[model samples]
Target: MPLSRVVNDPEALTITVVADFPVPVERLWNAYADPRQLERFWGPPEYPAKFTRHDLFPGGRSHYVMTGPEGDKAPGFWEVLAVDPGKSFEVRDGFADEAGVENTAMPSMRMVFTFEATEGGSRVTTVTHFGSTEQLEQLLAMGMDEGMRSAIGQIDDVLADLASFAAERATEAHILSDSQVRVTRVVRGSVEQVWRAHHDADLMKRWLLGPDGWTMTVCEIATKVGDTYRYCWEPEGEGEGFGFDGVLLESVPPRRAVTTEHMTGTDYPSTTNQMTLTPVDGGTLLSIVITYPSAEVRDMVLATGMTDGMETSYARLERDVLVGS
Candidate 1:
């Protein structure tokens, strides 16, 4: 399958399986990092896995059981050798009994989980090494290859559930002062993630726009201090639309950004904007403050219900761009 491949090196007493996922590395890594999630796809199609003691660190160990449709159970254990979040991990894989006792009769192997980010998606390489070629051949004869392929195919289901569970929620905005309007939102993901969501064109396009049916057609960004950025929104039909172009006055990723906005096709005057992001309990607390030249100019922009539009765009950005696929 395109998502997974297996290479059997009998002479070297090893087998390597590399799988590609059409999702972010963090999203895909959840399948293994989360114990409950790991249980969902750790077994073959006919046998489902159930994790018991899951300690994910160096020298930690995890025990699990694979239950067949008819109630047959095959237990297993993993002696974690190393761990690198969202990157890779190493473990010693072996068989065990229902009471979590190791089955010394069964062969053991060392397995490594390595993840890499790709242009189209993410790649995870699982390499298993045996003591000798005989051990590798023994497992191959017991349907190891087929079972692994079947188990890897189940990742799609996990990814779909993750996307739905991480769906975005709503946010609110208010007038902070006569010269400034402030919108405070707790965005999903880490501080760095929040920064990238605002800067990356692909991620920004998913939410950085006004109401429904109005689309952001052009988004050009230069995130340096002396650089400029432009965005354009056009209505679906022949109706006239609006957008804002800005030059960066100050820029600090994952922290703050200051800019001056020049609006087009409106009576709205130029405004200075300050956007600050702070790491918070859940995610990143994003504060957007827009300062107009005077109360008259500020009131003029507010009269156009720009605050309502901003609320819509920010809400979408928080929900869809940062967390969603």
Candidate 2:
């Protein structure tokens, strides 16, 4: 038997695999939606696979981290575009770095998997649509087709097992509290790269968002303790967008740096933010710890979608500082 393409068009390329299994549509759908069920059959059978986080909802996404035979781990994110319980689901897939940051990829595709009930059992057909033929060819040359085929086979096996169990697990809601959402990834890249991205006024503007009329007036790094730095953002009219200042508590060249970030817009005075960098395998682990005055203040900041903001910031850092440099 030879692999065949299902839909071949200028705008989309889809591959469908039809397998008749001795299971119902609901059981198979559970294997696709549930994180635990997905982990069982979501990757290369030879490789130990796991799903880090799987959130199936609009504006929600799932992250799967796969470790290869060489111990190198690669992360992938699937943004849930649509979900119809037990019938069909769609998602946008992309690659990310270790810090759970998405990369720059043009014309991302939609992967839709549908389940239908037949006389014998259930039929699963997965259709992936790329924006262009070049995109489809590029993905195929990258071995995406084979990888997905293996992954779906794993899903098939897991669903067969689930059918024997006769009990479907409930989906868990992915929710985070303000105080519980801590800054997770702190990566240490080359000092020149890091400095160029973080300290440079022009480059900072590309990643960090500011008010309507905001500019970086003062940015000084002494590379030592007791050094003070201030970033002043000017607003258009009568609005608070100034006096964002910090003090360098510790600084070591290309190794570590600690600073205190203060926001004048907040009701409270400020908070203590510490950043540390330690040398690791061919790189460094940069850890950031922000201590708030109270739990209430922390919750308020989290409620403002700061976690998502930081995730996007780190993604920019990876692209500009790590990849571009």
RMSD of each: 17.8, 17.8
Q: Tell me the tens digit of each residue's lDDT in model 2 across 1-325.
A: 1122344454436655555566776666656665556767667765545554455545556666677788777677888898775688889987776445787664467888888887766777777777677888887787776776676666556765734333221111121222222243434465356545665667776554432244445445444588777666555557655566678886544434567777756566576654433322223334345656667877677677666655566666666557746
Model 2 TM: 0.48
On TM-score, the leading prediction is 1
Candidate 1, residue 92: Cα displacement in angstroms equals: 0.4
User: How well does candidate 2 match the true structure, expressed as C-alpha RMSD?
Assistant: 17.8
Q: Model 2 lDDT vs. the true structure?
A: 0.59
For candidate 1, write residues 1-325 as lDDT tens digits: 4356799887878889999988888777756865545777899879988665455557667777898898888999999899886789999999999746889999989999998999988999999999987788899899998998899888778777853324243444445445656555667678788888778988778888778788888888867888988888888888987778879998766566788888766666678877766443356556666777787877777788766776688777766776544
Q: Candidate 1's C-alpha lDDT?
A: 0.76
By TM-score, how accurate is candidate 1? 0.52
Query: What's the CA error at residue 266 for candidate 2, in Å?
Result: 26
> Whole-model Cα lDDT per candidate?
0.76, 0.59
Weakest 10 consecutive residues of candidate 1 by summed lDDT: 163-172
